[model samples]
Target chain A: MANLPIKTVGVIGTGVIGASWTALFLAKGLQVIVADPAPGAQDKLRSYLEKEWPMMSKVGLGPGASLGNYKFVADINDHLGQVDLVQENGPERLEFKRGLFANLDAKTRDHVILASSSSGLPSSEFVTDCKKNPARVLIGHPFNPPHLVPLVEVVPHPGTGSEYVTAAMEFYRKLGKDPVLVKQEVPGFIANRLQAAVCSEAYSLISRGIISAQDLDKTMTSGVGLRWAFTGPIMTNVLGGGGNFRHMVEHLGPASKVWTEDMRKHEFDASNPQSLNELSNGVEEWVSNIDLESLEKKRDNSMLGLIQEKSKDAA
Target chain B: MANLPIKTVGVIGTGVIGASWTALFLAKGLQVIVADPAPGAQDKLRSYLEKEWPMMSKVGLGPGASLGNYKFVADINDHLGQVDLVQENGPERLEFKRGLFANLDAKTRDHVILASSSSGLPSSEFVTDCKKNPARVLIGHPFNPPHLVPLVEVVPHPGTGSEYVTAAMEFYRKLGKDPVLVKQEVPGFIANRLQAAVCSEAYSLISRGIISAQDLDKTMTSGVGLRWAFTGPIMTNVLGGGGNFRHMVEHLGPASKVWTEDMRKHEFDASNPQSLNELSNGVEEWVSNIDLESLEKKRDNSMLGLIQEKSKDAA
Candidate 1:
């Protein structure tokens, strides 16, 4: 498939991630067609759009963007040949994904790239049954609340054509998203794996009583998080090296080894009642009383301001 | 120390960290006495003060705060019996710190607490030689650019008094800083260790050519970084749990384990030419062309804005 400029996007699921994708696509002035079988899915999607439109406007919508330029269908077949690309946010079960992709493959055009927002499962695990055109299928997983967050991890399977990967990446970039091509299809990809590494240690620390959840959160929100907001660990490491990342490795590598070696692994079984209660109680000590909706609004507003600030010099 | 309100702060060694502390001290309306023997150190400190004053002003200076309230001395003896507390940012050499702290301990009043801005070395490593009032000495290590970043890891040695730790925490909190009392004196402390955990995996991925430094950075700066800027991984994990952290751990814990098991460890030896070249080239590809000064300004400005936003509802 050629690297076609995506003008219309079909959203295969209209839950949180799907609704977010809809908002972003609409903000970017792309025609969006959405389909979901759940009752009131369309109403929920419309409500989400209305609530998020003001924030989207402040974040700066693309030229000619309009909330009215969208279509929602109860049948997946309605999206056939209607969208240039399709974002599948269906249930994460492999069997469900396979069935959906098979039907989508038969229905959509051969060139219409089919991307799944599977966070952990690689596209190959689900796209195996897309006999008609597996080359156009891949994972274009966005971080949660995709409309606001810019990262889209585009992981293509071995059978996926290079052109399709490029097309999906270019499409996300056109929507003012930061699209990273996952060179290898590891489970959870890069972000979640990295998050797991840090979080495992965080869990161990909390469980061992070395620190409180509030302090751990403060350590990041006030300390390294500021740096990570703009520069990743690698770039920060480079600067830590005086612009030579190797120097940092030489000096800090042993220290890193020591920490990583001392790092603890935490495994909490869902079926274990004791472990669940302990973890739940600990979280309550820190954030149980927080008004989550208000906090989310604050977070979203702050994120919007920061995003606008970063995009100031963009061409 | 009875959590004595710190009024005058003596800053030893005026490098970037010391200068930043000086700026923050002045901004907080504390009388600052700085001592550094290096030639042109005073000029650099003055320049840093002048350069940072506007930003600090924007960040909000306390009543009676002024650059004029600061005094510079070439001799450490000048700070004797002069300031209520001391923040040492001396060279990261054990012998130098030992000798300097011994003199500082003997010269300053026993009631005054001494806090070192050492990034990795614990207070026990150097305070052993302080003959007088070593119990008042501890590490109050700040993140880079101490004035801008709010986190200060207050680590105390075994011999240090609990009251001194409490005093130090109270002092930093009074300055509008986030003081996390590190119960253990481990190398690199919590934030850096957590950072090392993530960076270790990042390095292995880059070294193995699974991903480029740029995409790896985008994965954080665009995805997890946003969450981290407001909520640390622990709180984020708790939120991920549907307000029941245990639930998240139960459901996502297995997934985290899978990722952690797949994680790789990296140790880069500076003497290894291949390691140095590989790491350096990877970072250069991402950040080589960017103007460092302007980039730093952008980062600092964004940080200032975010800090202000976060502080809006503070009691």
Candidate 2:
């Protein structure tokens, strides 16, 4: 954060997440060299970044001169020597990711930290046996849009060193993200696990006819979501149960019993690939039917204005 | 809601919730006649209104110019004949709430709806008999601040007419709230029940050394909380698992089974009141060591700004 020395960042893939990663790194005033073998990847990254940069700058997340910091290459060898960090945003296949990391570790300098933008996969799963110095390799998972949400889950593999963890956290902090260290290698880490917990309940509620998806969204947006944004669930309870969060734990033995007995678990088997076909079709349906992209765009503008209002109030 | 007459609202109690009720009604430009023999209850309600109104208006929830709609009477019989609605924010004791509802329902007009804001006890436990218009009574429960968060849980008693349910829902909708009607009486209704489910996990996390309360709050504020403010859990899952929410459910079931087994429940006993005493004292200790009133003021400002931002976004 104190006059960061990062001038350029190397991106290993140019898929959706990869392009987002490229845009994010570039937005922070760092030249981003996105290396991907996919045929139209570079052009896609270019178009996406060009379309997104102005909006990002409007939110004060990027400088208007963002395009100057972007570069796309079909080869990692072309960019590795000059960059400070290499971000891997490749396919979910372990073999592909592992091979990518191995090449990245071998090609990049010892001082450069290698980070991945994977949501669920642990760093150890793919980065193992990558180099003589696994000390510099770690997972720096960003939510969908790294430049916006301001959260990065930093997980260090067993072989990864403390210096790398510290550096990665500091690196993300420089980009205005609030990164939390994963003490151990959990399946989904902290955010997604809590997310899964809530999602389990949502699916159960929908499946049980207790509430529909839209009503559930409203229950949160109106009822619970308001508090969770500024404060977490525990603090919500603290203020909600009249300044004592433990009151729920202390008294509601019976209710707790019911929750445990009926609680649903989240799994990722993906048996009904058709369900995703249905869901993706649903997203397209939702988008075409309600003009969701416009809703998102409107929401972003509103959020940007709000963030400005908040900053001014704080001042 | 349609600029219909809100001449006098019968307020059936004058404790903390009742006082808050008085302020909220007055803020909404409603005449309220409060009934309470408890010393200083009327004065306290007035004092709270005077202090809270300016700030509330600054945050955009007050009809400040119309603040003349508040009245406190010594007798419950004073304004029953004229008021359009009766809000019973009385003691949580089943007998107390039941007796008040009976009195309010019997004495009030047939058109007026009687509502309680109890978080725990079900409406049916107290409002089963004696009211000539039983259908007019239900629970219109709110969180700590009924005026701010804008979630009203409307729960109708079994004997309550279906017509009143629609009326209550319509009323809240008019007030610009996202109100959900609990089809059948449940102990905590929807919001508190969802809250209890999450609280159980947070407590269990604390007990298991998974994270501290501070860290857990951070985990929420930085991660899950951000998405939650934008999308509900179901939609978050749909986005989380790479647009494959159902896929995550199917694949991760085995991993989730352990979570169900590991659910933690805390038990409380009233005879040994040390725990409750400890809780109260701990809060006292924490507050005494800090500028809690100023802290609350600071929180109010922050919350005000955030709510303003969200409302603007919604608009």
Candidate 3:
């Protein structure tokens, strides 16, 4: 295992996720080399960074962090040797990823860690094409707008090097990111699966006319979401049982079965046209009365405040 | 349809939920007549109030709110006629709730809104025993520690009066609570059903050794939970589509189905002894190292901070 510190990061494909990653890397005092063949990608990334910098500054920038520290490279392959680590946010096509990883594997040094920000695709599927040191490549998926939200799922395939896994976890931790190592290659990893679980039930309820989209959102923000912001469901259960896990399961188990049984009957499926239309229409009506741009701003601001509050508690 | 404000509340069964309701009522400047037949229930409730009062004060108490305005009564029946509303927090047994609601129905005036704090049992299940004015009885379920959390599920049965629903919604809204009217009586209501969905997936993942309990919690607290704290799943989907709900569904539909299909296969079933044991043991191991009391205190404090911050944004 190479013990070199990651001082420079290569960001591939400057989409929303990649741009956010670049902004975060820049804020953390790391030199970022960004590359995207798409027209105006550099300008868009710069604009996004400029717009998001104030909030990042409020969260406190790292030592020597600067807006001008990053360079927009024409080709990431040419700059691969200059970066200590690479974060790929390319398109989700399996063939595209396979070819990209193969190229990345050949260009980057064996010591350099290559991480993908793919939300769904696992590294193992694409790494089959990487002939050189595929062991160092893994999924470092972040929640949307990685610059703000702290979750990064550091999922390593069965063949991934344990040292690289540790390095990835430590790398994110040093950047003020909460990185969870998903033990096995699972679809959706941890956060998205949990999110899908909740969303399915939510869609089911909405489709069945048990609740409106607006009211369902209220149910979360006002109640469970408030507690969940700091504590996850399992710990929440533990707390609900008054710090006893056994007691909680024993008390709430039967009720949970009933709810899950009802929930299992429905899911948010695109194949089911009526179900999809019902949920989409409900959300459409809800958003019709909402100024989404302003709401997004408010949500980001609130998220910043919450992250700060939580970090203070952690400290 | 009496237009009288809910000035005074009768609190029956001052256990955890009931006591929390009393604290909120007292903080909202409502006269509370609390009754519990259990030994030392009054002292427990008093201590709980004293401990939680500081947080409530931090969230900014309602007009004329005071800790001393509530009276612990030996019998809530005598005071039911004096109170404008009755918030029952009795045992979960259907027979017990039926008898309690029957007595409350007989004693309280027709205009008095009787709301049960039951988490699972729907009002319709027990309202069959209410001989008089069963229309006024409904579920006013709050998330645990109702004094801090803003969500109140104002669920009314099919037979419940429309006036009572309006009154309950207005009453909670006046107290700065976010109450969502549950249009239909469903088991576990809205929040718990959503909660159960998430927990089932969480339990399944833990049991399958896909992730540790600790990391699962981190995934939530750091990722989806943060967003959920303010915006919910459906609205999140809309935002993901860049303020277009249909776009989000269409774009992410295929992936979401894959996730939900995988998630639907496993559930946290109490009847399946191994599944139950695996989840319980995982949680047990995770909590063993955690100082739950201190964690609970930290969670509550952080929750108070987040709630205060969110309310500021809303303002």
Candidate 4:
């Protein structure tokens, strides 16, 4: 079967991620059908879209793109017949997702791609309950503020058709997103796990009193972060070693190994009160003087400028 | 003794790092005396300073700052008496560093701070041979393109004076550099270790064919890296969980642990021809159609713009 063209996208659960996804799809000239059970989801989503549309326009908007092209419904089933694709952003509970997928599978067209925005859960876990054609089910997780951040992790279940995966990747690419394929199901997918590795080590260092949270953030914002904003770790290694990653490894391997061996491993047990207190106390102390909203605004503006600068002279 | 102000900076070994340091110091209105033994080193250093001066001026130049304020010499001993601080960027070998530190110890003023630009070698390893006040010697490692990148890792040997460490930190701060004080003498320091952790995971994913190098780069440049450029992993976690880092850990800890345990460790051995070939081929293939030079230019320009934007509302 040919891949379905995604001109109208169904967004289930109009929360932050879903709303942002809706805004992005709209900016790409796609009509978005938003479904959420919350009492004021329509108002919330409308305000969000209005707030983000200017920024999206500055970034770029497809021909005839406008917020008026979207529709809001309290029921997902009502919009299933209208959208060519469904983006599920329901609660992360497996049971809830499983039940939702089954209902979505029953109502949506057989060829419509049903993509869950779950961060870590594999689609295979939920699709097993679906009685209808389950080959169209997969995970298309986006980073936060999906309209701005360009990553969309396209993860496919083992039972998912290869063509659907390709189609999903193409769809996201058409929306100006970089979609990375998750060949195998891994917990937290790729980005989250990588983030965890760094986070765990950071927690350990802070707990041990080696550095303050402000300094740690400064360490990144001024150093590794600069390198990462343009390239990945592997390419940075290649550049570090003068176009040879192996050379870098050979020269700096022992030091890196020692550090890795000493890296802290934090077990995230919810029952542990100390861990939570420690992290919270640290963060509050670090942000004592700075207002979070302004800091975040500064960050967003900088990201916007960076994206604009990098896209210039694009081939 | 009070910390001596740094009006003159001596740059040893006028290579890329040294030349960059010279450009930065000169832009900050510090008279820099660059010393290198290599033939035509003066001409090369002069050319580099000339090319970077315009960009440096755009960023900001202190009063009386000019490229002509810098001088070049073929002997380190000649500039020791003239500079208040010496930034060594010699070859990264313990034997050579030991020799250089000893010479610098004997030639420099008793109050002068002798700092190394070594990326991995801790100052303690080489400063042991500095008979005259080894406490004054430490590591002042800068990220690449010292004139542009803001991070400078200031690492102190245990025997180094507490005052010297504080002075070094303040000095770098005055020059508009984010100097992170490495609490302990850890190899690879904080930034590089974090980078290594991420690199190891990325290499593992690529080797397993989960994602291509190009897509991996995109994943970072578009996702995690965007957050990181503004904040560290720890702060990001705190924000991720709505001002609670611990909440994030409790929810995502198990998945993160699984990924960390499964992370790959690549040992860089020059004798291992296979590792070199594999990585080189991978990078070349990812960069096949794209020109590396243009890519790098785009990165640098984006970085400059990001820096400009971030510094606007600086408190």
Query: Each predicted complex: what DockQ?
Result: 0.64, 0.36, 0.83, 0.60
Ranking by TM-score: 3, 1, 4, 2
lDDT of each: 0.83, 0.67, 0.88, 0.80
Cα distance off (Å), candidate 1, residue B169: 1.9
Pairs in clash, predicted candidate 2: A267-B248, A267-B249, A267-B251, A267-B252, A267-B253, A268-B248, A268-B251, A268-B252, A269-B250, A269-B251
Per-model chain B TM-scores are 0.94, 0.85, 0.96, 0.94
**What is the per-residue lDDT of model 2 for residues B151-267, given as tens digits with 9 covering 90 to 100?**
788888788788787877776665556787777675566666566566556554544444445556666766567556666665555554555555656666555544443442332
Query: Compared with the true structure, what per-residue lDDT tens digits does model 2 show for residues A84-186?
Result: 8888888777888888888778877777888998776778888775865677888898875565666688888888888788888888877767787776676
Question: What is the per-residue lDDT of model 1 for residues A101-208, given as tens digits with 9 covering 90 to 100?
Answer: 999999888999999998988988888788789999999999876888888999999899999988888899888888998887886788998898777777666655
Question: Candidate 4 residues A190-261, lDDT tens each?
Answer: 888778667766766665556677778888888888778887787676666666555676777667766666
Interface Cα RMSD per model, in Å? 1.7, 4.1, 1.2, 2.1
lDDT of 3 at A111: 81
Please give the RMSD to the true structure for each candidate, in Å.
Answer: 2.7, 5.0, 1.5, 2.8
Off by over 4 Å in 4: A264-279, B264-278, B288-290
TM-score of 4: 0.92
Give me the candidate number with maximum lDDT. Answer: 3
Instruction: Please give each candidate's TM-score.
Output: 0.93, 0.84, 0.97, 0.92
Predicted candidate 4 versus true structure: per-residue lDDT over B236-282, tens digit per residue: 76666766555677777666666666563332333456654665567
Error of 1 at A249 (Å): 2.1
